[model samples]
Target chain A: MEVVHTIADLQSRIKAYRRRNDQAVGFVPTMGFLHEGHASLMNKARSQCGLVVLSIFVNPLQFGPGEDFERYPRDAERDLAVAEAAGVDLVFMPSVSEMYPSPTRTTVSVSDVTTRLCGASRPGHFDGVATVVSKLFHIVQPDQAFFGLKDAQQVAVIEQMVQDLNMPIEIVPCPTLREADGLAMSSRNVYLSPEERQQALVLSQSLQIAKEYIQSKSSQGFTSTELASLVRAHIETAPLAVVDYAEVLSYPTLEPFDHSHSISSLIIALAVKFGKTRLIDNLILQVRK
Target chain B: MEVVHTIADLQSRIKAYRRRNDQAVGFVPTMGFLHEGHASLMNKARSQCGLVVLSIFVNPLQFGPGEDFERYPRDAERDLAVAEAAGVDLVFMPSVSEMYPSPTRTTVSVSDVTTRLCGASRPGHFDGVATVVSKLFHIVQPDQAFFGLKDAQQVAVIEQMVQDLNMPIEIVPCPTLREADGLAMSSRNVYLSPEERQQALVLSQSLQIAKEYIQSKSSQGFTSTELASLVRAHIETAPLAVVDYAEVLSYPTLEPFDHSHSISSLIIALAVKFGKTRLIDNLILQVRK
Candidate 1:
């Protein structure tokens, strides 16, 4: 696999593939510290695409002040090895200066969708995500781009941006990968202490409990408030886990769940802090017909 | 020349050309009354690019609530004829419903530069232009895009967006085409009455006077306020021409002109109302080294 650090170099390498007319380029954009979750996304891209381009850049724009941008885990050698093992044809590892040599005056923003969940807690996060993804999409010019559903809100924001901008690339959303104990895999997982890591399982556990509750009450249906309270109660039982937000919202549109309507599919998302480490997890509950 | 009305049809036609690595695609996006200025841009694209795609979309997003959106001049037949004569390979004339089938939730916005000149008078105008231009750029995926220097502010907004987003296409700015009477050619010029048209020449005439003043006073650099007052005084001479805005500002940046710094290259822009028709013109003055 070829590794390139500059935009011009990446474009030059991709130019020949672009001109061939027969090859389908797939792209996977990440913030390095690659794990099984990222590997799953790259594997999916490799299964169907003729060329796979993976990018690893710790984007500072997405992190708010006091966020973990300074200590965000990065392993370039390991990341390159992972990409090569996952069948990535080209890996783009751009420096911060290469990605943003000057102050950025342009912003790509999606309204309504970016005002809830993690967006509310982390201001300007989705805007940063949308902008960097837009830059990467233009640079890669891929036929299909892969994103992990672990960051469902990020996926939704990108979907809205692509649809609104009429971008020609297709967004392929891969399923979220989990640890053996059911904790969702995240790059920030490195921040967890032994105790915090053990307590983090409460996030996935609460989601699982919500799934079962919905299954039991599938016929009668449940209010979003009821499901939220149930999940919040479960996480609060874990002494270390402090609930930040546990709310149920409609899928894709992400509107507040309405009790007046019959429940079909809803996203139960949560963010919790175990000690100093924050973790987020979600479950998409659909009524079994 | 092939004329396509739907995005799907246009994409299909351009797909083959996109696959062929050797061809360079050039794009010209317009609101479609096809004046000499637009023809000049298309001709420039044809001279340099292997494929020329012209899009005629009367973007409603760019028009203010009380602006002339409903009555925006459009001539599909004539536009196609002009494009064909100018050697355009593809003409994309999408309907309003086709371009925006649903409410747009995404916006591409530029800051600082958009808060001055025309942006001050027409709020959200540059945002609309940036969004639609972004869509067209993605759809066409052109090697180069052409814009007329006549709408210099629009060109600045687009340039900032392309650079910030790292769009791979090069922006080629073509010189403004003028009539024998010195009026800058515009589709909106059709709205002018013969008497109003005659009076509208003052828009360009004022710019010319400002240029001459700047040239004559080059030794003793004039303040922006001084040049603005000079141009405003000239436009007010015409009985029918009412000065809307006449200001001198820094180029590209469009910042308020600083009197402290010696003028190098500055943009003197003006807008005037002749009866109910509004016309705008500008001149870029550079110091002769």
Candidate 2:
């Protein structure tokens, strides 16, 4: 329930906690306006770790000039209640000035993997995510860090960053938490009008359709084109759903699927537009090896 | 004196050592082939940290094609001796295969500042350096990291990385160590022929002359074209020295000299080619307030 502000205070507290016998720390980093998705992440962290530390930072570095940095939803009191309900221990909420003093110039990038999908749409977005996540990882020095698979490309980028940087914390990929209607939850869900919220359900349904297709077939792999067409048709058919991109990719790598790619490693990734908000969801179907 | 090759072993050992107490860890990351310059960095780390860990890695991602990645010098035994003499506790010398498993694909960058100086010539060089250094910072988990001002641009880039990422480690910049004749020390100093060695001295001597010119009230800061000419002439006159660039700059910012720049932050930076190895040197002089 303790909300720390400064880096020094946080580090000192984490260090002290480390000394009082082996305490396993778990971290969940988020931009504010928490939802069930963030709660699931905290739950995952709380399940395994002695202390769960969650960070609510709407990092400006990740947002392009035209992006939703200014308008990004933030409500710390409600977020605190959600964290408390989720059994979180500490909340490390830093101010923009505290996070980035003047002359802020550093960035953490995950190379080629970051150059695709969300990276293509929002350039340097993942760099900001990777850098902020890395900072949280260092500050909390967590035993395990939990990230939801809802942001599949972000999960990939973080995995690459931790591996490339040799960070000690274990990155646990939590299953994407969805609403009762099969809509994958996101903080930006707040941005959606009631009508837009109803349309967003198509994204998750399309992903489910892809998953069901692969699960039904005893084939080696479906062509990337066929899968794309099916998902695109689903999105285009809906009045509220507009297909931003619907592609089959190699799991983790984000490379376009080929005939050589096995069904077990195929990722049906999609970006669909519902009004002003762009929501991404992917289904990674694992078949017999 | 201990050389740990595997990432797991080093991580385990470091974790165990860290458990003993809150010992301040200091780090010096380098490509092996240790010279006095590197030894001085180790000595600095030794004095500042309870445990000094030096990692020697010639990161491939930082080098472009036609760059000397394959031919980059390395001498583990010599590096070990120097590290040992300098009182380093652990020397992490990981091979490419060990540090980067086959599918490595992440990078860290420092923007703006990286877009200038060394970044201009080497393109993605600082990106590579930032990525590797970030990896090192994570792996070593040092309280402070040491860097040489010999690579003034690298120091700036790293400072950017450390700040931008909000990494916990302090970046300590050591003065550029030099040979008796004024040649700045570098691992590539080995590549210099006996004649090339003499020519390399011009890089430093030219800066020394510039320093004296500014001290003697060589024209007003930005208006002193004569002082700039003298600085360039010193390098041009040397038979083995080919001037890469010689310019007066504003320190820290690395901006070209302009009328508005504060005199207190004026800096003179130079780069020269002595045979095949390019050498760099700089001198910072305070401008009148």
Candidate 3:
């Protein structure tokens, strides 16, 4: 229930929590416009950890030049309420200057896993995410960190980074939360007009169609190309929907599976533009042996 | 001292040490061969910390293609003896496969500070050093990590990386230890022939010349170009010495100081080739305001 703005204050609070019996801290890092997705992560942390730490910083590093860096939503009061409700022990909301005191010269980058999907569309985006998450991980020094599979590729990238770097923390990935209508929850959903909001359903709907197709015995031995085509054709049915990318690749690695081999684990990822708002959703599935 | 090869073993040992009264861990990461410079770092760690952990990894990532990676000197028995003598509590000597079981997909890189000096001469060298050191820091989770100022630019890059990432560890830069003949201590020093070793003294000799010149009040307001020429001229006196680089720049930053600004702290760095052996040395000086 304590809120802190500076890194020093947050560290002191975390230390105090640890000093009083070695607390198992869980961290949930977000760009703070608390939707059901972020809250789900926080609630998961609260359930499993002794102390839950939530960071709400609209990271400018993750946005491209013409992207929504400036227009990224902020709702500190609402976010604080949500954090309190989720039983977060500490809330760290640092200023841009406080997080990045100077122009950052250091970068934490993961290759292969970051070359496709959202990473392909937004260059240097995952580097920014990786760098910021690295800074947050160091600052929080938590036992486990929760990440929503809403940004599935992000979870993959972060997991790869942690494994490759031998970072002493666990990455607990939570299921992506969805609306009653099946639309994936995201802060950027607020950017959609009423008509655009309705059209965005094509994203999750196409993912569902792909999921059913993959689950069907008739769809056995389907190549990535065939699966991608099925998803793309379905999304194009929406007049307002413009398919940015519809990719069917190996999960986490994001690499195209060999057609000669049977698929084991796969992810069907989509990014579609409904007006100026670009929405993304994905479904990870495991094929039966 | 207990020697561990697997990361799991090291982590378990470190955890046990931490569990008992919160011991302050000190880390010394090196490429083995056990020179006096490394001993100095270990000695410093031994005196200051409750437990000292030493890692001997001749990181392949730091060496350029066609460089001396295969020929990199290592002496596990001697290194173990040296660690025991220096009072190191744990020695982590992971095999190449153990350290990098898979191709490293993640890279920790620092810009600006890595763009000059050895970074320029050896491409991707700092990235390798940065990545491995990052891995070691995470695995050990030491209170303070010791590094030799013999590799001054490396110290700067690591310092920058630690600051940027907010790594909860201190970087202790130990002074460069040298041979009685004035050559900087390095594992690569074993490559030098007797005559080449004699000529290698020019690397440190020139640093001494620059240090003396900078200290003599007459050298006030001297430009980097003037300082470089004076040192370069002295280094050229050695018959076998082929000056690879002899430059003067601002300490740590490695950027050239502007003539309009009065110099406060500066580093004169040298890299010289004697026959096939290459040696490097540097001197950091503070001008009286």
Candidate 4:
């Protein structure tokens, strides 16, 4: 696999791939930390297209002033090895200056969908996310782009943007990969202390419990309010976990649905803090018909 | 020239063009009235790109209440003839439903740039302009997109957005096309009554006087206050013309600039109403280095 250090080089390579006529480019954009989740996105891209391009750009604009931008994990050597193992055709790793030459000002924002969830916590967060993703989309101009369900709100924002802008690429959203303990894999997970990491397991553990509760129609079965309360209660029990948000949002819209729409393929998304580090995670809870 | 009615078709055509190794795609996005101004944009696109695609979408989002959305003049047959005459590769004419599907929710806005000129007269006007332009840019994904300098502030806003978002597309700003009488060409010109149409010349004439005043180094030459008064006085002299804005703005940034930036360009852009129809015009004076 080839490693590209500049936007121009990456764009030229993709431009050449397009010139080949027979090759289909599949893209996976990640903030490289070399987790299994990132690998799964690459695998999905690999399975779908003749060539896979993975961009590891830890975009600063997407993070809020208080967010973990300066300390965002970077493991380029390991990330490259993972990409090479996953059969990535090219790895695009652009610097901030390469991605953004000064006098840069444009932004792409999907309107209403961006007003809630993570957007609710960090203002201009989705705008930053949407704008950067749009830039990557144009740069890659892929046949298909892969995103994980872990960043459920992000997927929604991108999906809405592609649909609204009439951008011509298939947005393939894959299931979020998890660790053995069901913790949604995230780069920020490394920020957690060993004890805090153990406490963070309450996040995914509660979702599994909720899933079973709904499927079995147990006494603990939840309405939207009850589900939120149940999740909040479990996180509250974790001394190290200071929950930022614990809510069940409708699939795709990320809107706070009353109990009605929470049953079929709902997303249990949340953010929690272990000391100064904020970790986000989600579980795709399938409610049995 | 091919006519594409759907995004799917445009994408395939664009893909095929890519497969053939055509690197240049220049776009002229417009609302169909087929005036010389639009032709000028297409001409630029034709000169610049290997393939030129023109879209005539009378974007509803850009039109305000009491604005001429329903009454906006459209002549697709005439527009097609004009586009064909201008050497365009494709004319994309999508239905309103196609551009704005229900549940459509995305908006792109530029700060302060939208706070004046037409934006001042028509609330949410720039918001509309920004949103539609973003949509068009995404759909066309052209290497260079052409826009008129007649709407100088709009140009600045778009440039800001491109800079902020790191959009890879080049924005080509064309000089505003005007009638022999110096009135700026616009689709809304069709809405003017014969007398109102004749009176519309006062707008361009006022700006011409301002230019002459500045060039001749009249005592009021360098004073923004004096230039604004001269423009306003000329427009007000014609009783039928209601001045929407008559200000001298530093070109490109549209910020108030005097002798500050030695080589900065200045644009005195304004709009007026001859009867109820709004007309816009501008004079961009590139300051000597």
Candidate 5:
């Protein structure tokens, strides 16, 4: 695998690839501390595309004030090895200066969808994500880009941006990977202490319970409010897990679900903090036929 | 020349062009009533690129409430003839429904630079330009895009956006085309009555005086404020001309210039209303040795 750092070099590489023949390029953009979740996205890209490019940059714009930007774990050597093993053709590891040599005046902002969930918890987070992703998309000029469904709201925001801007790249959303104990795999998962890690399973557990409840009672005219309360009640069973938000919202749009919304349209998502580490997990309920 | 109306057709056409071989694609995006200024941009694109694509979109997002969006002049048959004559390889004329099939939730906005000059006069105008330009850039996938220097602030905003987002396309700023009387050519010029059109000469005349004043006295430490007042005084000579904004500011950044700013870094721009028809013009002063 070739590792490129500069934007000009990467464009030349992609150009060379394009000149050789017609081959679809796939891109996976990440913040570096690679794990199975990232690997899953790369693997998906590898299977679907002729060329798979992965970018590992800890974008400072995405982090808010007092966020874990400083403490964010990064191991470049390990990340490179993981990317190579996952069949990534090119790895773009740009320095902070290379990515943002000067202050950025342009902002890619999505309205309405960003007013809920993670958007509320972290201000300016989705705008930063949309902007950086836009820059990366232009830099790579990929036919398709892979995004992990772990950040479902992020996936939705990016989808909105792509559609709104008429970007020709397809967004392939891979399913979220999980730990053996049912905790959702996150780069920030490393921040969890032994006790916190154990308690983090409550996030996935609550989601699983919500899924089961929807499956069992979807035919009985179960409303979104009832499902949300049920999910909240399940998470409350774990002593260490402090609920930040537990609600059911309309998928894609992330609008609050009313009785008129179909069960299939509802997504039950939750964010809970165990000690200092916050974890989020969600499940899209399948409607009963 | 091929004319494409749908997004899918345009992408396929661009794809076919890319498939042929290595060729630099040049783009010129405009609102439809093609004038001599737009033809100049097309001609520039024709000379420099292997293929030139022109997009005519009368974007509604750039128009505020009570603005001339509905009354925006469009002559598709004339525009097509002009583009073809100028050697445009492809023309994209998408309908409003086709360009914005749904409500746009995403916006590409540039700050600081957008807060002055025309931006102050027409709120959200640059955001609309940036967003639509971004969409066209993605849709056409051009290697270079052309803009007229008459809309100098628009060019600066786009330059900032392209740089900030790392868009690979080159922004080629063509010189402003003017009539025999020195009035800058614009699609909106059709709105002017014969008398209003005659009075509109003051817009360019004022800019000319500012350029000469700066060129003559720049070595003697001419200030931006002094030049702005000079231009504003010149435009007040015309009976039909009502000054909306006549000011000299720093180039590209569009910030108010202080004594520390060099003479070459300044751009003198003006917007004047000739009766109900608004016209704008600018002149970039050359620094004397």
Candidate 6:
């Protein structure tokens, strides 16, 4: 796999790629510390595309002022190895200065979809994500971009942006990967202490419990309020897990369910803190008639 | 020349063009009623590129509540004739609904540069320009995009957006085309009355006067305030012309010059209303060292 650091180098490489033939380029953008989840995205890209480009940059824009921008986990050697293993054709590892040469004056902002869930919790977080993703999309000019559903709201925001702006790229959303104990895999997982790690399982467990309940009661649907409470109650069992937000909303739109209409699909999202590390997990369920 | 109305048709046509071995597609976006300024852009695009794509979209997003969106001049047949004359390979003339299938939720906005001149007079104008241009760029995926320097602030905003967003497309700024009477070529010029059209000469005349004054006293640079007044006073000489704005600022950045530093380049921008029709013109000057 070829690893490029500069935008000029990557662009030149992209030009060369385009010159060869009509190559379907697939991109997987991530913050370094790659795990099985990132590997899945790269592997998925490799399966379909002639060229798979992976970008590893812990975007400072996505983090809030008081959030974990300073000490975000990054392991370059491991990330490159993971990329190579997943058969990534190119790896773009750009520095903070490389990504943002100057203070960014242009912002790609999406409204409505970005006003709830994580968007509400961390203000301007999605704007940062949208702007950085836009830059990456322009740089890569990929045919299809792979994103893990671990950040469900992010996927929704990106999808909305692509459609609204008429960006000619397909957004392929992959399923969220989980550990053996049902905890969602994240770079921040390393931050968890033995006790915190054990408690973190509550996030996925609660989501799973909520999913099964929704499935069982599919015929006679529970209100959004009822489902949210059920998820919250389950998470509270774990003493260390502090519920930041546990929401039951319409998938992709992130809008609260209108009780009058039949709920076809819903995403039960969770953001809970265990000690210092905050872990998030979600399950998108399609309600059966 | 092939004329396409739908985005799908354009994409298919673009794909066919791309398949013909690394064809350089140049784009010229305009609000119909093609004047010599738009023709100049198209002609320049044709000269440099393998294929030229012209889009005539009278974007409503740029117009303020009381502004002339409904009255925006458009001549599809004439525009196509002009495109063909300029050797444009394709023309994309999408309707309002076609361009915006839904109310646009995503906005590509550039700050600092957009806070003055026309951007100040017409709020959300640059955002509309940036958003639609972004959509066109995505849909067409052109190698280079052309913009006439008649709308200098617009050129500055687009250049900043392309740079900030890393839009892998070259922005070629063509010189503004003018009538024999020195009025800048604009689709809106059609709205001017015969008398109003005569008075509109004051817009370009004042800018030209300021340009000569700056060139004559390049060594003894004038303050931004002094230069603005000179242009404003010249425009005031025309009884029918209402001075909307006449100001001098640093080129591209649109920032007011500081007397602490020696001035190098300045853009004398003017917006004057001749009856109900507003006309704008600008002169970009390079200080003779």
Chain B TM-score per candidate, please.
Answer: 0.97, 0.94, 0.97, 0.95, 0.97, 0.97
DockQ of all models, two decimals each: 0.86, 0.69, 0.92, 0.59, 0.94, 0.89
Q: Which ten residues in a row have the lowest lDDT in candidate 1 chain B?
A: B256-265
lDDT by residue (A79-165, candidate 6, tens digit) is 999899999999999999999999999999999998888888899999999999999999998999999999999999999999988
Q: Residue B225 deviation, candidate 6, in Å?
A: 0.8
The alpha-carbon lDDT assigned to residue A181 of candidate 5 equals 87
Q: Write the per-residue lDDT of candidate 2 for residues B1-289, one digit (tens) a residue.
A: 6889987878888888888867798899998888888888999988878888999999998898888899999877778888889999988888898877865677676777765557777888987888778778877788899998888878887887777667788999999888888888888888999888877777888888877767666455435466668888988888878777776666777776556555557657777787678777888766776
Give each model's whole-structure lDDT. 0.89, 0.81, 0.90, 0.82, 0.89, 0.89
Q: How do the residues A239-276 of candidate 1 rate in per-residue lDDT, one tens digit apiece?
A: 88888889899877777967665556679889998776
Q: Where does model 5 exceed 4 Å of error?
A: none
Per DockQ, what order, best first? 5, 3, 6, 1, 2, 4
Question: Please, what is the TM-score per model?
Answer: 0.97, 0.93, 0.98, 0.92, 0.97, 0.97
Give lDDT: candidate 3, residue B148: 97
lDDT of 3 by residue, B1-289 (tens): 9999999999999998888857689999999999889999999999999999999988999999988899988789999999999999999999989889899999999999988788988899999999999999999999999999999999999999999999999999999998887888999989989888887777888888887776674555567898999999999999999988898998877888867767677889888888767788899988665
Clashes of 6: 0
Q: What pairs collide in candidate 1?
A: none
Which candidate leads in lDDT?
A: 3
Among the numbered candidates, top TM-score falls to 3
Instruction: Give residue A179's lDDT in candidate 4 (0 to 100).
Output: 88
**What's the residue-level lDDT of B222 in candidate 3?**
68
What's the distance in Å from true for residue B4, model 1? 0.9
Residue pairs clashing, model 4: A104-B163, A104-B164, A105-B163, A105-B164, A106-B161, A106-B162, A106-B163, A106-B164, A106-B165, B251-B266
C-alpha displacement of A244 in model 3, angstroms?
0.9
Residue A103 lDDT, candidate 6, scale 0-100: 94
